[model samples]
Target: MTLWRLEWLRLVRTRRLVAILGAYLFFGLTGPLTARYLDRILGGIGTEGVRVQLPAPTPADGIAQFTGNASQIGLLVVVLVAASALAFDARREMAVFLRTRVRGAAAVILPAYLVSAAAAVSALTLGTLAAWYETAVLLGGLPVARLLVGLACGALFLAFAVAVTALAAAITRGVAATAGAALAALLALAVADGLTGVPWLPTRLAGAMETLVRGEPATGLPAGAALTAALTAGALAAAVAVSDRREL
Candidate 1:
């Protein structure tokens, strides 16, 4: 309880979250606005009499654009934040007091992963909500049930990112190494899923998110959800194990 509380308190007390949320919020607004006004935006900058004809933007188009930005750019932010989850540590002598006082290394890792996942999920949820509302006002509202499914797709990927980054942290030191490893692992998952056509990978969930947003059936949803749940638990266990083996 104390660890969870500490992790949550640290997350809320920092300025990093404000910046991350603001960045995602900007994307949520701009993605739809860009899709909605692409013609005008291009026409305004068109060379004299050079016409740029564009297709009529659909709900799917706007949602696709938003998800594209969130999955790639938004994903980067999640990795960076999650990578920093374990940036603090005391020197060997200085670490003794707190290190020995806790239940185990898992106590440190679980709270960090859980708290970071919560924060990332919340940011994505709010950002998606903003994008949804703006799409309705500026474009057209996606059907509510489908919209929720699409949102879950992105949130699920974020949870995986958080878990993967926590695992990276447990095994590595420093922000760059943790983030780099985490990104590498996620990319590997994507590539493997593509080659193997596995339905249970977190990358599948992310891909399914895009599919769902576009009014298509996410046939892989069930398997992806099951795998995500399993992988999250497994990744947390791995993190705890690695952290335990480390010299505090």
Candidate 2:
């Protein structure tokens, strides 16, 4: 069987595909609902002597909530699922089997990495479409062109995330360790971007949806998106090189 087909079969058989899609779908459906009802929801809490005033819910707020959920828990799920696929060689028997059949590390690893990335991007796109529909119903219609651009930016960031998982898997000995290392690296990048407020940081793509929804000029997004794509390619290359040298 082709490696690509094998990866897809593995993802489905293991149910990671379902988990990733389900998590994003849950957030997509709830994000708009939460944004629309947030004021009433807060009022029900009944904090004594605390008056909380919130702006009326907007389409931007709905999309923001969706991206916010995606950037947090959704991102982690993607990383874990990607790590599981990339780290399949963690078992000695599996490693030997793959090493013997594949021409090189790239042959063994690229399909798994690309399949994981494709699954993640597809899930995110599905969730984004769900959020867009609910936002149009609950709030108002958003700019389709801007939202599409933002979605592209978000997809690039997710692809980069999977690449990071691939690199971590190449270096780490187990699935958990690979996931942890990739998450740690991502967290550090997020913190750095938060502190520096750099326009070119790939982390900026995480907020692309909210920003574009608010009608912000996507002037900075191109830089961030380019950097994200570059980083993803570099990470994939590094993963292949590192895996090539490692002892099976």
- What is the alpha-carbon lDDT for the whole of candidate 1? 0.77
In model 1, where do residues sit more than 4 Å from their true spots?
45-49, 87-97, 193-200
Where model 2 places Cα greater than 4 Å from the true spot, the runs are 48-51
Clashes per model (N, Cα, C within 3 A): 0, 0
Best by lDDT: 2
Judge candidate 2 at residue 24 and give its lDDT.
89
Across residues 112-156, which tens digit of lDDT does each residue of candidate 2 receive?
Answer: 988999999999999999999999999999999989988898899
Residue range 122-213, candidate 1, lDDT tens digits: 88888788788888888886878877876787787788788888788877777888889999999898789889986667887665545776
Q: Give me the candidate number with maximum TM-score.
A: 2
**What is the number of residue pairs that collide in model 2?**
0
The window of 10 residues in a row where model 1 has the poorest summed lDDT is 86-95
